[model samples]
Target: MSLFPIFLKLTGRPCVVIGAGRLAESKIESLRAAEAAITVIAPRAIDAIAERADAGELILRARPYVEGDLAGAFLVVAATDDPAVNRAVFAEATASGVLCNAVDDPPFCDFYFPSVVRRGDLQLAISTAGNSPALAQQLRKELNEQLPLDLGDWLADLGNLRREVVTAEPLNESRRLLLHQLAQRHVCAYDQCPSRLLAREHARTNPIPMEKA
Candidate 1:
């Protein structure tokens, strides 16, 4: 069966990471970037992870995994070195109906963390279905170089214009086509103001006709 692709809303949501090694640290960083409230469980934390905990970046619980640790969590990550512990966490997550990721174990994971590239509010995720994470990381690096830093800002501007157009105009096939074309054209442009204005003018000029009663 194919794994389903999902984008979760983690802002202000509780996320539990059951490990404190390098892999767990990476997961914590990613979750922090998404503004998730993170709680990490580990008997021994590495220097970097300890520093983050000391700096008040994440909440660290210096204890072993317990049964109710997965309770009230929106998401969980199992990155321990022990395969048995990881499997146990996965089972608990499944029983609780919480999304879980067992690092480097595709069979045990409900979701796999993808190598990601972030530019402001824009994010690109690349996954290999656990077949080759190295390849995914390499592709993400290549994409990082290809994507301009200003693209995120441009995308945000286009999004705002799209919302305005959708609200101001009637929903019709012609309007939808025009909007799609405008979005595609402006997304690739460096300067968005002119393109946005042109789109608005085009929409104004081609108003949807009302049928006679």
Candidate 2:
């Protein structure tokens, strides 16, 4: 299925998960990582979940999923092992126009969690469109190994330099070429030093004029 992939910022927003097992625990962790305020509804929860609830990390309702639980939720995850309960949760979420994800059920999910690799502020996500989650996870691991640990820092530096270049000079073919050259030359340097400073000095020396010869 063709899906429009989009990244969401859920910091401090309300999210609900209708299960307390391993799957629900995983979803809760992911939401917490995103800084979402999460509430879990299940008849019983694992020790970790119970602890989080007790610690006020999340709101845990030690009861079965109810129809009104979908109210005021920004996102919903139906992770119960019981198909009937999962279906009910999906239906309530759909009726409320909230985004829903039913674990292992693509048709019932409005969104699917991707396998992610996070480094500092850099995040890389991989998904198989809910087809093969294991493969997606494997690819994420492979990419984590292949990518350099310092790449994120380098990228952040390059991004700042790009913004400066764009603001310092108007957009034109010559300016574009200069930025491209600079990016290609310094995009691999993670540690900022006199070498990078010298490189920038040299790059600024020869600005190609936009006028045709």
Which runs of model 1 end up more than 4 angstroms from their true locations?
A: 187-192, 206-213
lDDT of 1 by residue, 59-159 (tens): 89999998889999999999999999999999999999998999988888888898999877788888788888899999999999999778887778778
Evaluate all candidate structures by whole-model CA lDDT and list the values in order.
0.85, 0.83
How many pairs in model 2 have backbone atoms within 3 A of each other, for residues 3 or more apart or on separate chains, i.e. clashes? 0
**CA lDDT for candidate 2:** 0.83
* Highest-scoring model, lDDT: 1
TM per candidate comes to: 0.84, 0.79
